[model samples]
Target: AEKGTDRSTLMDILWDVQRRKRYISEDDIGKIGQAFNMSKTELEGVITFYHFFSTTNRGKYTIYLNDSIVANQSGRKAIQRAFEEALGIKLGHVTPDNMFGLYRTPCIGLSDQEPSCLINFKPFTNLTRDRVFEIVTELKSGKRPSELCDIPKSIIHYTPAEERTVFFKPYRQFSSLSILNTYSPEEIIDLVKKSKLTGRGGAFFPTGLKWEFCRNNPSEIKYIICNADEGEPGTFKDRVLMEEHPELMIEGMIFAAYAVGASEGAIYLRAEYMYLRDRLEELLSKYRSQGYLGKGIKAKTPFDFDVYIHMGAGAYVCGEETALIHSMEGKRGEPGTREFFPVEKGFNDRPTIVNNVETLCAVPRILEMGISKYLSLGTKATPGTKLFSVSGDCSKPGMYEIEWGMKLRDFLDLIGAEDPCFILFNGFAGECLSEADFDREISGENLLAEHMQFRFKDPLEYARKMGGIGLRSGGSFMVFNKQRDLLKILKNVADFFVAESCGICVPCRTGNFLLNKKIDKLILGHAEQQDLDEIKEWSNIIKITSRCGLGKMSSTALNHAMLKFPEVFEKRISANTDFNKSFSLEGATADYDRIINEMTLDYD
Candidate 1:
């Protein structure tokens, strides 16, 4: 093995080894162990733990189909039918041409992308039969299609001519999310200060600022956490980071540990990421044994740091900082208020620092590239690139990283999305956008401002309002084509929110449950104008009164449904304006009883 290949290289070696045939045998394993200087037990542990690290040959193009709620809603079975019919293969079966391998993985964060499929390590979600065929044909021909595929002739004439710039390229290899191992606290801090990198895990907080805050705080045993539990719907960018560059994450954690005076670090990864977890653990062991970690000489100065991987027991709410801390402590993953930020009172009640997986992963580049260079590449307020899981109505769906301030058109083009019918920013519970919002830039300031403009409008006006509604933290845009029923789509989204909301507060728990019932009633061809009015009233009340960001965002579904897709509700209301459409007196109450009964899946 070559010396000083970096932590990520070790993971690459393991990945390469797993793809070989002879390595499956005991003798081959021993030889491989000797080559990498690893024990047989360690080698075997790594190979067996991960489901993806196969000893047999996988085709050049491997496909991972994730079965999740979004896929379920979008008729995932239909997507499978389309792919199999088009490709001449069944689930988990590859084509004879060796051009593709098919397998099933769990959900990627982008539920909209769920029923999500990976083609040659790239993601494509929100698939339709027609779209799937287009993708397969394009791939089969070895030509990657671009977002221009979705442009209608009416709109095409309005678009500007494609222009080239000196500094910017239309495409480039995504910068590897890796970092050099460093021990010195001052050195690590200096690197962070120079990189001008901001955290990719929601909030877009400047990473260097976070380190500076934790470093200045008075705490002897500070804790640093990498929030790897990517639970948001319509977002799956983090998983790619883990599978492709596990060591960059570790190096980032180590650098953060040093900067903040943290001796130990923990990665709170989601249970769904079992494959990534296995690969990461194997990489950690190998890197440690090679003196890449611990005191006295992985490289130069002495820096003692170690990382532990803790699996989360699948809860969406646990993505919150407080809840994550609770989960790590073996407690119920419920959140408390932000009276004392995690930086002041975190894990085990010690001064702690929690950063997202993407945030930690970006640390090394900041060290390598220096701050001024980093700052010059992105917008002034939000420097550095943002990663997005672009799926939904787009033809070529995948995770993309682009510098801040890039236009929405450029972004969609980079991700190869055809024109979107409607874009749902943030997560499932966020606002839905019409063509009116397409030209707007995606950024923290723009999203916030757009949402607030809708604060005082009628339902439709409010829905149409731009800004303040997009994903500044974590969210994906779900695209809907003209063929799809917008009303049914909104109801499907409402059903998911009602099902997932933890029954903590009345607004979220009871209120959301009721909202879904009303939407369902409208979809079933029975509802009154009064019913729609009541739903809106409840949305406002719950939105304002609910605790945490989840509840506040939950109302967005109802808000958008009323404003953006008013015809769905208005059609029923106009027919029953006289209040005589066979709605029983107990129609509202009885539905609640039924919903409560079916709340939990295991309520036997």
Candidate 2:
């Protein structure tokens, strides 16, 4: 109760209660609601929207096993079996002794090290069946998960000195802030514009233009938000940036604050990265002590900016800016209408500038290196290097810093992708590419120009005409060898979207569910040519009609794979034309029967 009853602090309070008591009880909810002047239903809605917060007892140790496709490929089933055997309880259940609870969650940004889990939010990576058994034994012996965590200090691949780019290069403290007084805010924006830096979060929006819009707003209160919610499956570059170079990112936020005339700022760290919170908080305190943050920062000009960390409780849709702002205001993280961008009305209805972790990390480096040096690194259209989170079927599954326009084939070679047949670029929400398009370049210019030309038209036609994939990625490059089943991968992607959809709009909510059903049909050898046609039709509708990026691009991988690898789907089609032969009543009712059985068991 001492943490003040502001609406913005509701998430923090809920997190605190959950950590202390292992669950938010009915009495706790009533007390919190009374303090915040919110109803019980409203509080329950907020709590249920996130995956991490629980209303039931989660026991002493909560284990969230990663359910990404990479994890499955790397023998997740065996590890899961080991945990179940060790704990003597199935997933989604607490042990009878009340010592542990096991659950499965989506990607936790540790795709490079598959079969990983977060025990009390502390990541334990690169797991095997034996390792899982050992971990469970140690935990039973009263060893803290934090002490037994095997997460690597750095997952970045070690490249030669010459291969190192802007982000991975050696850093100096406050190098950019030391020169903040030299240029006016407009000049600072101009320098960023000249550098041609775009949003590294995959939208590719001009960073300088976004800052310019926020700065041009006449609001007295402004906000600078660092989007550290790296929730996309197969993407973990932002996590690496936060772990290795958080100060640089914070400095970039300071630069944004100075440019946009904002005083308050925040880092929206995702719940998966709860482990990074203490270290980041310590860094923020050190900066404040060193005069790099807090009021009258560095005692320079009259401008003052301070930043705090806001934790996300596991909503993938919250990665969107409007949803993120809504989450910050202590509401369900749902994307609001885009009548006005966040720059005009955000964070309690004020001007706000939101930048991803990689985008912000580059800000201080760009200022330090100057425009000419930065621009000369990448292509003319998309200047500056990018961090690619390479994983899945690669000998070197880690973060790779490279120039923007590198070829897909070259990247595969560099990462030692063994007999790569398919690559899911960007993410599940992004496109899939086959070996036929290996010559295409990875640059924002292709995606931007193609988007301008096509503008909701047929992307497959654009690919054929341009002889390129023409899609910009958010730096998740997951490769798959020929030995892997594309259908299973497609099923995983479908399930991810279905699980993560915010259900705000009809198209995304229904479309993802239907898509997953179709993929299941194909996997079971029950899909017909008609199902394939319907899949394409539904995918197009979801992309065109969905409200936010999550819904809009939810079917991208399926669409791309259908267009790129027609043979994969063709072979899965059922030969029997009779509906009675293809469809099994028992199979169709299995899910319903299972749900009823589980509910009856709980009642008993």
Candidate 3:
């Protein structure tokens, strides 16, 4: 093992071991334990947490069909069935020939282009029954992933490219990193602060203060982390940035490393993005060859910066910074108390700075252009543009970057949303608002003429007028049309929470399951008013008492749905008769519901 190798690199060793031998044998585990000076029990515990790494032979190829809300909406079930029929094997098991293993995976951040699946982490999106059959045929003939079919085109902007970007537009086209050298670490921090940048991973922590804290915390060894583990159901903006704008995102990471005086950085990428790993590593090698990554790359500079790309094995809670650190360390992806934040003691008890992919991508641009230029794009408190992953019932479903504080209605119209009924502002764990909301059509188009601008003196006040704080989403905007069933959508969101609970704390681990059960009851026409009251009570307990943010906001979609669309739930409640008539519950909901809402599967 290298000197930098420790328990944190346990996942990497396991990944390599599995790749080389199709499984981590007992002898290999013992040898890895000895190499890292870790106990075999500790190694086994780490290995068991993630679904990807296995101690036993999985198969020659692992086929992961994404069983997410969007996947089901886009007909993943039919596609999955096609795959099984073609392969002559059931899911979650290998074929009789021991050639393939099929399994269900959570959201793979391809909501806009679903139904999607991963063959050994190489994504094939926009799936259909015919495509599945074609893929299986090719695989049977010994075709590689790249030879199967062309990867989907980059899901970049929905609107015209002319209006989308300030830096990324030109930079990705022509600009290389200039490696700004005119400022000290404090000076760079001041510039970022002046830009008023915030973390885009939903927390909205001020970027400058985060960098300053990491910089102030002196340590012999320090780290910077670019969080690209975007497991949120409706969120795929990070995927866009990683695929279309790798250089820009990498430059951002490099700038953060320079600002925080750290040499090492890592992109904790989601396992679904395994296809991106090769291209990004090639780009990084180009950076190193161009004298950008290695020691003293800049003339007369003492900075030494380089980064590693680490893949996560399908854990949504790992999106949290602390939990991300633990996952990178080859441990279970569970968040800890904020008392010892990653900035103070993280990733093997060293000062670490973790920033979202968008935030890290913005750092270099802020340093390149003057902070004033960057600040001019967005609002007073919220500065700079935001990228939203817009899917569902929209004509232009893809990634769209807008100046912050765009009116909800204008955004809707701009994205060509048809009959915009309701919109999910963030992911499954985020908020959902509908045209039936308090200020339904505040997009200013309806307030005045269809072609008029929706000007506001203050964007925050405008958001308050239109709806709640959904305008400040971390960048997921799934537009649901009138044809979409609100009850089914709410249940989908509830079931996602149930499936993704990290199981570390009971309030979340148990509360989310019970919440899904209550939703199921309503869907099944078996619920009285008591179920609603109990659900509300359980939601409060989970939100207040859960150990992490995943649980704290797990009930947002359900709570909002019940409050805004009470009639949807009321219609499904049992009639005055003993007969139940709500089995549309089974057919109306997405296919993922059947998997998640199965009463036979018990969780501790």
State TM-scores per candidate. Answer: 0.66, 0.92, 0.87
Which regions in candidate 3 have their CA more than 4 angstroms from the true location? 1-5, 25-31, 34-40, 158-164, 172-179, 299-301, 437-472, 574-576, 579-604
Candidate 2, 459-498: lDDT as tens digits: 3244334321233457888999999999999999999989
lDDT of 1 by residue, 1-604 (tens): 6533332233345445544431255766676667666777866654554445555545666666665444655578888888889888898777887666666654555453455565543456556788888888777787642331221111011121222111112222223222333335665666676665555655444566667767877888788889998866667667767765666677778777767777777888875564466678887787678655555424334456777777664467667677778767644465655656566788877767778877876666555555676666556655566666655666555565666666776666655555455566665667777666667676544643543221343422322231112234564556665555666666766666665565567888888888888877776656777888898899888777766556667767568757876775677766655446665668769988788789865586
Show pairs that collide, candidate 2: none
| Model 1 poorest ten-residue lDDT run | 151-160
* Stronger candidate by lDDT (1 vs 3): 3
- Summed backbone clashes in each candidate are 17, 0, 1
Residue clash pairs of candidate 3? 8-329
**Model 2 per-residue lDDT at 458:** 50
Q: Candidate 2 regions off by >4 Å? A: 158-164, 447-472, 574-604
**For each candidate, C-alpha RMSD in Å?**
12.1, 6.0, 8.0
Tens-place lDDT per residue, model 3, 180-227, is 555666777888888877777876666787788788887868899999
User: What shift in Å separates residue 519 of candidate 3 from its native position after superposition?
Assistant: 1.1
